[model samples]
Target: MTNEKKKNTITWIALVLLTILSWKFSESLSGKMGLMVVILASITKFFGVSLQFLELKKAHSFWKFGLLGFLVIFYFLVFLFFS
Candidate 1:
Protein backbone atom coordinates (compact mmCIF):
# COMPACT_ATOMS: atom_id res chain seq x y z
CA MET A 1 0.00 0.00 0.00
CA THR A 2 0.94 3.64 -0.34
CA ASN A 3 2.63 5.54 2.50
CA GLU A 4 -0.42 7.62 3.26
CA LYS A 5 -2.65 4.56 3.43
CA LYS A 6 -0.12 2.82 5.63
CA LYS A 7 -0.02 5.74 8.00
CA ASN A 8 -3.80 5.82 8.27
CA THR A 9 -3.91 2.11 8.92
CA ILE A 10 -1.37 2.46 11.66
CA THR A 11 -3.24 5.31 13.24
CA TRP A 12 -6.48 3.35 13.13
CA ILE A 13 -4.83 0.40 14.76
CA ALA A 14 -3.41 2.60 17.49
CA LEU A 15 -6.81 4.11 18.17
CA VAL A 16 -8.37 0.68 18.47
CA LEU A 17 -5.68 -0.52 20.82
CA LEU A 18 -5.96 2.60 22.91
CA THR A 19 -9.73 2.18 23.14
CA ILE A 20 -9.32 -1.35 24.41
CA LEU A 21 -6.69 -0.28 26.90
CA SER A 22 -8.84 2.51 28.20
CA TRP A 23 -11.77 0.16 28.63
CA LYS A 24 -9.65 -2.30 30.51
CA PHE A 25 -8.27 0.42 32.70
CA SER A 26 -11.75 1.60 33.46
CA GLU A 27 -12.78 -1.86 34.51
CA SER A 28 -9.62 -2.53 36.51
CA LEU A 29 -9.23 0.86 38.15
CA SER A 30 -11.85 2.97 39.86
CA GLY A 31 -12.35 6.65 40.68
CA LYS A 32 -9.66 9.24 39.82
CA MET A 33 -7.13 6.86 38.34
CA GLY A 34 -9.60 5.44 35.84
CA LEU A 35 -10.75 8.88 34.81
CA MET A 36 -7.17 9.93 34.28
CA VAL A 37 -6.35 6.96 32.13
CA VAL A 38 -9.48 7.37 30.02
CA ILE A 39 -8.87 11.06 29.51
CA LEU A 40 -5.26 10.46 28.51
CA ALA A 41 -6.31 7.82 26.05
CA SER A 42 -8.98 10.11 24.63
CA ILE A 43 -6.45 12.87 24.09
CA THR A 44 -4.15 10.48 22.27
CA LYS A 45 -7.01 9.26 20.11
CA PHE A 46 -7.94 12.85 19.31
CA PHE A 47 -4.43 13.54 18.04
CA GLY A 48 -4.43 10.40 15.94
CA VAL A 49 -7.74 11.39 14.40
CA SER A 50 -6.51 14.90 13.67
CA LEU A 51 -3.30 13.74 12.04
CA GLN A 52 -4.55 10.79 10.05
CA PHE A 53 -8.20 11.31 9.29
CA LEU A 54 -8.39 15.10 9.36
CA GLU A 55 -5.17 15.52 7.37
CA LEU A 56 -3.87 17.95 9.92
CA LYS A 57 -0.34 16.63 9.63
CA LYS A 58 0.12 18.43 6.29
CA ALA A 59 -1.55 21.59 7.49
CA HIS A 60 0.23 24.70 8.67
CA SER A 61 2.05 24.60 11.98
CA PHE A 62 -0.26 27.16 13.51
CA TRP A 63 -3.36 25.11 12.75
CA LYS A 64 -1.77 21.88 13.89
CA PHE A 65 -0.48 23.35 17.12
CA GLY A 66 -3.64 25.27 17.69
CA LEU A 67 -5.86 22.24 17.41
CA LEU A 68 -3.69 20.09 19.62
CA GLY A 69 -3.25 22.89 22.11
CA PHE A 70 -6.98 23.37 22.34
CA LEU A 71 -7.53 19.70 22.94
CA VAL A 72 -4.87 19.49 25.63
CA ILE A 73 -5.93 22.65 27.40
CA PHE A 74 -9.59 21.76 27.40
CA TYR A 75 -9.00 18.24 28.56
CA PHE A 76 -6.54 19.33 31.21
CA LEU A 77 -8.93 21.89 32.56
CA VAL A 78 -11.64 19.31 32.79
CA PHE A 79 -9.32 16.84 34.43
CA LEU A 80 -8.23 19.42 36.95
CA PHE A 81 -11.73 20.57 37.71
CA PHE A 82 -12.99 17.07 38.25
CA SER A 83 -10.02 15.64 40.07
Candidate 2:
Protein backbone atom coordinates (compact mmCIF):
# COMPACT_ATOMS: atom_id res chain seq x y z
CA MET A 1 0.00 0.00 0.00
CA THR A 2 0.97 3.61 -0.42
CA ASN A 3 2.35 5.67 2.40
CA GLU A 4 -0.79 7.79 2.63
CA LYS A 5 -2.95 4.68 2.87
CA LYS A 6 -0.71 3.29 5.54
CA LYS A 7 -1.06 6.38 7.64
CA ASN A 8 -4.82 6.30 7.33
CA THR A 9 -4.92 2.65 8.30
CA ILE A 10 -2.81 3.28 11.37
CA THR A 11 -4.87 6.23 12.44
CA TRP A 12 -8.08 4.28 11.95
CA ILE A 13 -6.79 1.49 14.12
CA ALA A 14 -5.73 3.92 16.79
CA LEU A 15 -9.13 5.55 16.83
CA VAL A 16 -10.87 2.19 17.14
CA LEU A 17 -8.70 1.13 20.00
CA LEU A 18 -9.16 4.39 21.79
CA THR A 19 -12.88 4.10 21.39
CA ILE A 20 -12.99 0.62 22.82
CA LEU A 21 -10.75 1.55 25.70
CA SER A 22 -12.83 4.57 26.52
CA TRP A 23 -16.00 2.52 26.39
CA LYS A 24 -14.57 0.04 28.82
CA PHE A 25 -13.45 2.81 31.08
CA SER A 26 -16.91 4.29 31.04
CA GLU A 27 -18.36 0.94 32.00
CA SER A 28 -15.95 -0.04 34.80
CA LEU A 29 -14.77 3.32 36.01
CA SER A 30 -16.51 6.31 37.49
CA GLY A 31 -16.00 9.80 38.82
CA LYS A 32 -12.99 11.82 37.69
CA MET A 33 -11.01 8.88 36.36
CA GLY A 34 -13.64 7.87 33.85
CA LEU A 35 -14.28 11.41 32.81
CA MET A 36 -10.60 12.11 32.28
CA VAL A 37 -10.03 8.96 30.27
CA VAL A 38 -12.99 9.62 27.99
CA ILE A 39 -12.00 13.22 27.55
CA LEU A 40 -8.44 12.30 26.67
CA ALA A 41 -9.63 9.80 24.08
CA SER A 42 -11.99 12.40 22.63
CA ILE A 43 -9.20 14.92 22.27
CA THR A 44 -6.97 12.42 20.53
CA LYS A 45 -9.69 11.47 18.10
CA PHE A 46 -10.44 15.14 17.47
CA PHE A 47 -6.90 15.88 16.42
CA GLY A 48 -6.56 12.71 14.41
CA VAL A 49 -9.72 13.33 12.44
CA SER A 50 -8.99 17.01 12.07
CA LEU A 51 -5.44 16.60 10.82
CA GLN A 52 -5.90 13.51 8.67
CA PHE A 53 -9.48 13.39 7.47
CA LEU A 54 -10.21 17.12 7.45
CA GLU A 55 -6.92 17.93 5.74
CA LEU A 56 -5.93 20.24 8.56
CA LYS A 57 -2.40 18.85 8.59
CA LYS A 58 -1.69 20.85 5.45
CA ALA A 59 -3.42 23.93 6.79
CA HIS A 60 -1.45 27.06 7.39
CA SER A 61 0.16 27.27 10.81
CA PHE A 62 -2.24 30.00 11.87
CA TRP A 63 -5.30 27.89 11.18
CA LYS A 64 -3.67 24.77 12.58
CA PHE A 65 -2.71 26.44 15.80
CA GLY A 66 -6.03 28.18 15.96
CA LEU A 67 -7.77 24.85 16.25
CA LEU A 68 -5.35 23.73 18.89
CA GLY A 69 -5.87 26.89 20.84
CA PHE A 70 -9.60 26.54 20.58
CA LEU A 71 -9.49 23.06 21.99
CA VAL A 72 -7.25 24.17 24.79
CA ILE A 73 -9.47 27.02 25.78
CA PHE A 74 -12.58 24.92 25.52
CA TYR A 75 -11.21 22.17 27.68
CA PHE A 76 -9.78 24.59 30.14
CA LEU A 77 -13.12 26.25 30.47
CA VAL A 78 -14.81 22.93 30.91
CA PHE A 79 -12.48 21.86 33.66
CA LEU A 80 -12.73 25.18 35.39
CA PHE A 81 -16.47 25.27 35.29
CA PHE A 82 -16.98 21.63 36.14
CA SER A 83 -14.51 21.62 38.94
Candidate 3:
Protein backbone atom coordinates (compact mmCIF):
# COMPACT_ATOMS: atom_id res chain seq x y z
CA MET A 1 0.00 0.00 0.00
CA THR A 2 1.00 3.59 -0.51
CA ASN A 3 2.10 5.86 2.33
CA GLU A 4 -1.03 7.96 2.14
CA LYS A 5 -3.26 4.94 2.45
CA LYS A 6 -1.23 3.75 5.42
CA LYS A 7 -1.61 7.10 7.11
CA ASN A 8 -5.34 7.11 6.51
CA THR A 9 -5.70 3.66 7.96
CA ILE A 10 -3.73 4.61 11.03
CA THR A 11 -5.76 7.75 11.49
CA TRP A 12 -8.99 5.82 11.14
CA ILE A 13 -7.87 3.35 13.78
CA ALA A 14 -6.85 6.14 16.09
CA LEU A 15 -10.20 7.88 15.66
CA VAL A 16 -12.05 4.68 16.45
CA LEU A 17 -9.96 4.10 19.55
CA LEU A 18 -10.51 7.65 20.70
CA THR A 19 -14.25 7.32 20.27
CA ILE A 20 -14.30 4.18 22.35
CA LEU A 21 -12.12 5.81 25.00
CA SER A 22 -14.39 8.81 25.19
CA TRP A 23 -17.42 6.60 25.56
CA LYS A 24 -15.77 4.73 28.37
CA PHE A 25 -14.74 7.94 30.05
CA SER A 26 -18.26 9.22 29.83
CA GLU A 27 -19.48 6.17 31.68
CA SER A 28 -16.84 6.40 34.39
CA LEU A 29 -16.21 10.10 34.94
CA SER A 30 -18.23 12.94 36.40
CA GLY A 31 -20.33 15.15 34.18
CA LYS A 32 -17.88 18.01 33.69
CA MET A 33 -14.88 15.77 33.27
CA GLY A 34 -16.67 13.53 30.80
CA LEU A 35 -17.78 16.48 28.75
CA MET A 36 -14.25 17.84 28.65
CA VAL A 37 -12.78 14.52 27.60
CA VAL A 38 -15.37 13.94 24.89
CA ILE A 39 -14.94 17.43 23.52
CA LEU A 40 -11.17 17.05 23.44
CA ALA A 41 -11.49 13.81 21.52
CA SER A 42 -13.94 15.40 19.08
CA ILE A 43 -11.53 18.27 18.47
CA THR A 44 -8.75 15.84 17.74
CA LYS A 45 -10.91 13.87 15.32
CA PHE A 46 -11.98 17.08 13.63
CA PHE A 47 -8.42 18.14 12.97
CA GLY A 48 -7.38 14.74 11.78
CA VAL A 49 -10.23 14.57 9.27
CA SER A 50 -9.73 18.16 8.14
CA LEU A 51 -6.02 17.86 7.60
CA GLN A 52 -6.04 14.47 5.98
CA PHE A 53 -9.33 13.80 4.27
CA LEU A 54 -10.15 17.42 3.52
CA GLU A 55 -6.60 18.03 2.23
CA LEU A 56 -6.10 20.93 4.61
CA LYS A 57 -2.57 19.84 5.28
CA LYS A 58 -1.51 21.27 1.93
CA ALA A 59 -3.52 24.44 2.34
CA HIS A 60 -1.84 27.82 2.73
CA SER A 61 -0.91 28.90 6.22
CA PHE A 62 -3.58 31.56 6.25
CA TRP A 63 -6.37 29.11 5.57
CA LYS A 64 -4.97 26.61 8.04
CA PHE A 65 -4.67 29.22 10.74
CA GLY A 66 -8.10 30.54 9.96
CA LEU A 67 -9.64 27.13 10.50
CA LEU A 68 -7.75 26.73 13.74
CA GLY A 69 -8.87 30.11 14.99
CA PHE A 70 -12.42 29.45 13.97
CA LEU A 71 -12.51 26.14 15.78
CA VAL A 72 -11.05 27.71 18.90
CA ILE A 73 -13.91 30.14 19.21
CA PHE A 74 -16.53 27.57 18.24
CA TYR A 75 -15.28 25.01 20.70
CA PHE A 76 -14.91 27.55 23.46
CA LEU A 77 -18.48 28.61 22.92
CA VAL A 78 -19.65 25.03 22.93
CA PHE A 79 -17.84 24.31 26.15
CA LEU A 80 -19.27 27.41 27.76
CA PHE A 81 -22.75 26.65 26.57
CA PHE A 82 -22.69 23.12 27.92
CA SER A 83 -20.73 23.66 31.09
Best by lDDT: 1
Which window of 10 residues has the lowest lDDT sum in candidate 2?
Answer: 74-83
lDDT for 43 in candidate 1 is: 98
The Cα local distance difference test for each model comes to 0.95, 0.86, 0.89
Q: Over the stretch 1-83, how does candidate 1's per-residue lDDT look in tens digits?
A: 99999999999999999999999998998889988999999999999999889999999999999999999999999999888
Question: Which should have the higher TM-score, number 1 or number 2?
Answer: 1
Question: Clashes in model 2: which pairs?
Answer: none
Ranking by TM-score: 1, 3, 2
Query: Poorest 10 consecutive residues of model 3 by lDDT?
Result: 26-35
- Tens-place lDDT digits, model 2, residues 4-59: 88989899999999999999998998877777777788889989888987889999
Query: Residues 1-83, candidate 3, lDDT per residue (tens digit)?
Result: 99999989999999899989988998998778888998899899988888887889999989888997799788889989999
Winner of 1 and 2 under lDDT: 1
**Every model's TM-score:** 0.90, 0.87, 0.88
Comparing 2 with 3 on TM-score, the higher-scoring candidate is: 3
Best by TM-score: 1
Cα RMSD for candidates in order: 1.2, 1.4, 1.3
